[model samples]
Target: MPLIVFCGIPGSGKTTRALQIKEYLEQKHKCQVVHLNEEILQMEKKEVYKDFQAEKFARGFLRSNVEKNIAGNTVVILDSLNYIKGYRYELFCLARAAQTQHCVIYCECDPQLAKENNSKNANNFTEEMLADYNNRLEIPIPKNRWDSPLFHLRSKEETPFEEIANVLLYQAKKSKDPVSTAPEIKFEINFLQELDLRVQSVIDELVQKQQESIQSNVITFSDCTEKLMINKQISLIELKKIKQEYLKITKHNPPKRIEDIKNFFIIYLQKVVERF
Candidate 1:
């Protein structure tokens, strides 16, 4: 799992560099790259620039997608301003949790030239907004674990494809020793409580719906006996523990169907019992 994060102000050619790297990795290294920026933009119904809530939503969406991708053997290019060091640290923690390799690419550009470039785009940032972001920008430092393996590039310079590929591919491979160790999964106590509530909510909804359908004679009781197994087998304490592991794999990739959710619960119960 390789996550390449792009950090730069608007009009700093971050997207261009990200795309070039994506193409090089896909073509040369035969690596799968998920361009998260494109996906986020596609999901947006309105303009996100200058809108705090929209930007926050987009970032959350991007994070979920990145989480889902990093769980697999693929490269994820996070094409965004990434001006916040705290956010970068969060991503660094996620990569660590997923046992993936990650790096940061900072596209350094002249402020005046960047504004000039921004003027050419229809969705360009306003001068005030650009200045605000610049003032708040927390440049990544090489010494930071979240920003290590950082690659600095000029706005218009060609991306060093070979160097980037080597860092992500060969260097990452070399770092992985023979002894296989599992990544430690942790969750906040309140978050586990919240997940339990969510699971209970889903169970409650399904049970109510099943009762309604049964009363209408649309379905018989026998049809739901196996489905109700989740309610019977799920213990709050056991659920809290299993849910920690369950969410590690599924928080970003939730089940789409009710049956699948029930199956997941059943499978979780089986695994818990098997451990004892």
Candidate 2:
């Protein structure tokens, strides 16, 4: 499997190039393509790209979708204005973790041309929004590891279809090996017991502090130099919810050593509590 990401400003023909590649892959290589587009997912542009938090949520949702679907004879195509380098890096990491190769197809076009095209289509992107996006755009650099294997398409006709298809298909068809995954890690019974005990102790301490009407306090986790800081009033329900999330995260990728468990949990608490 391979992930082909299309990134550009509105009206740069990202969707067109994505669909072109999708057709070529399907017809030539018999590849099953997963075309991911904001329109396809029924997301409102004004809502999703409204603010930092909204964009972050949208990106997280798209990343989760890629992670969930990138398996078994599928060629994933993410079509969007992926103008942020940091977000592109996250996608690269996700592809690596899934044991698949990925590439970016940047659709380069004149700002005026893009604006005209968008207006002709009656797209949601306003002139101000498009200009802001252009100003904020971090063009892909081939020197960066994540941005390597990048292709440029100034127009639909300029798409590097053959080269892209070759890169994505060669290893996929050549290798019969299954997707590589990290070996399952087993936590010892003693370590598990301690984990539960310490987690409960943390919850009780925080709940007691809340009951006592403490607005802010620093709580120490055992055997760690770092401390947990609670700056806002948190309810028991919220605390329990955070606990469940912590458990879920730890379950997937547990601390390598039992000694590190307390530190890990404390760090996790600091992050989750800071939002409250």
Candidate 3:
């Protein structure tokens, strides 16, 4: 249930960090992992944000895809600019609605380095766009509602993958998924809790950091069901189990808050264990 979102400009080492996290999570935790950049975009053949139409289309699709992936064994790591504040908030809402646990890793690099990396990449974005992003980018001040766990990597030398690994390992410890190979699933829970607290500490953090400019965009659970059926990703039996077991666990009393989501998942996992 770990949804790790990376936000940075085109050449800010977001993809690099994301790959590092993916490698560590898979190698250290032995948990099934999915790289959203590779899977959701390149492999899944999904469109990405470029203009208004493309960005809207991709954002909607990305949100749904992230939620779906969380229902599986793989912990999904989403790599994107996620530059828009409201868009980031929407992600928070989606994860909460799905009862999935999440963390945010903000990758920041020197503008010089960012520009250099952008120029080096064959498919790198336009300089104008990168310049605009850097100009207008509002760094996320800690906020409770988002439950964002931030790691500021400042080294121009390298991304301190080892330090980031320590933080992830801690969070994994807190997750305490017995089968999770992540070194600190249980510890991450603590780290995340602390991060959330820091976000809450700032008064009017919501307004100060709110991503409210965007319109409401939501994909219903019904939509998810349709997609699953059409795609045939899960068996009919598994679908039935998800419904029956989710209903049994939720007790018709749906989750109202992010924390309640933990119980919903615990129930889901319990059902899986029982079946085996």
Candidate 4:
């Protein structure tokens, strides 16, 4: 079973769709469904959304649960306000690292309807948060690989239950034969130096190509699967900065295979580059 995340404004039927999918999987498919949310987490939604520290703790808690329950025969449905695009990317990476499938189910509705629904329920949530919903939202775009396999369920529309099951279940089962090392990566002290050197070489090559093409807007790594699309002017200094940040992110957790240094770095570069 794969990880299915729900995202939308408050009262946008995220919880509703999550429960529906959970029931659908359990009854229709006879699979164990882990419905992870505030109730299961034993945390108040108000507390989780009240401030930064609280939200961080809550997100970390849910993330841990998702990581643990992502595997096995359980279908993990995370019911939350996953309005943060970066957070969704983190989920995507987790899925990639796990060698599992993941999808985003975005519940859409009129903001006014959402606000009114939230108020009527008034489940310990403040009225002030309603207005911030749209501002806080980082809408998911399907073209973004991280946000791919996305589903949009507006009010009154039935969720694509079979389609959802097909992607996470049938497709996943079809490709489960490969050995997955993402959960158990190992490396040595010398490996760290090699990783640093490998990343720097990639930077050197990219900068060289940039200069060779007289600073072409687009640069491609023929050896790597990742694609880097420049939306604006990029410089050597900026490329170095991106490399450093990428290293920092992977410092404690390098690529699953040492040989994949270039591929992993290029993938990360595209992600960071696209943000600009």
Worst 10 residues of 3 by lDDT: 223-232
26-52: candidate 3 lDDT, tens digit per residue:
787676777876344652222343555
Candidate RMSDs in order: 14.3, 8.1, 13.2, 9.0
Candidate 3, residue 29: Cα displacement in angstroms equals 1.0
Least accurate 10 contiguous residues by lDDT in model 4: 177-186
Residue pairs that clash (backbone atoms under 3 angstroms), model 4: none
Candidate achieving higher lDDT, 2 or 3: 2
Pairs in clash, predicted candidate 2: none
| Sort order, lDDT high to low | 4, 2, 1, 3
After superposition, the stretches of candidate 4 with alpha carbons farther than 4 Å from their true spots are: 122-124, 180-276
> What TM-score goes with each of the models?
0.62, 0.64, 0.56, 0.68
Q: How many clashing residue pairs are found in candidate 3?
A: 23
Better candidate by TM-score, 3 or 4:
4
Residues 1-276 of candidate 4: C-alpha lDDT, one tens digit per residue: 588988888888877788889999999999899999877778888878887668777887888899998866788898988887766777777776676788999998898788777776646367677667668898888976667789988888988999999998888777555564333445686888888888887788777776676555666775665545564656988988988877776764466567777767776776566445
Deviating ranges (above 4 Å) for candidate 1: 38-40, 43-46, 177-276
CA lDDT for candidate 3: 0.55
> lDDT of each structure?
0.68, 0.75, 0.55, 0.77
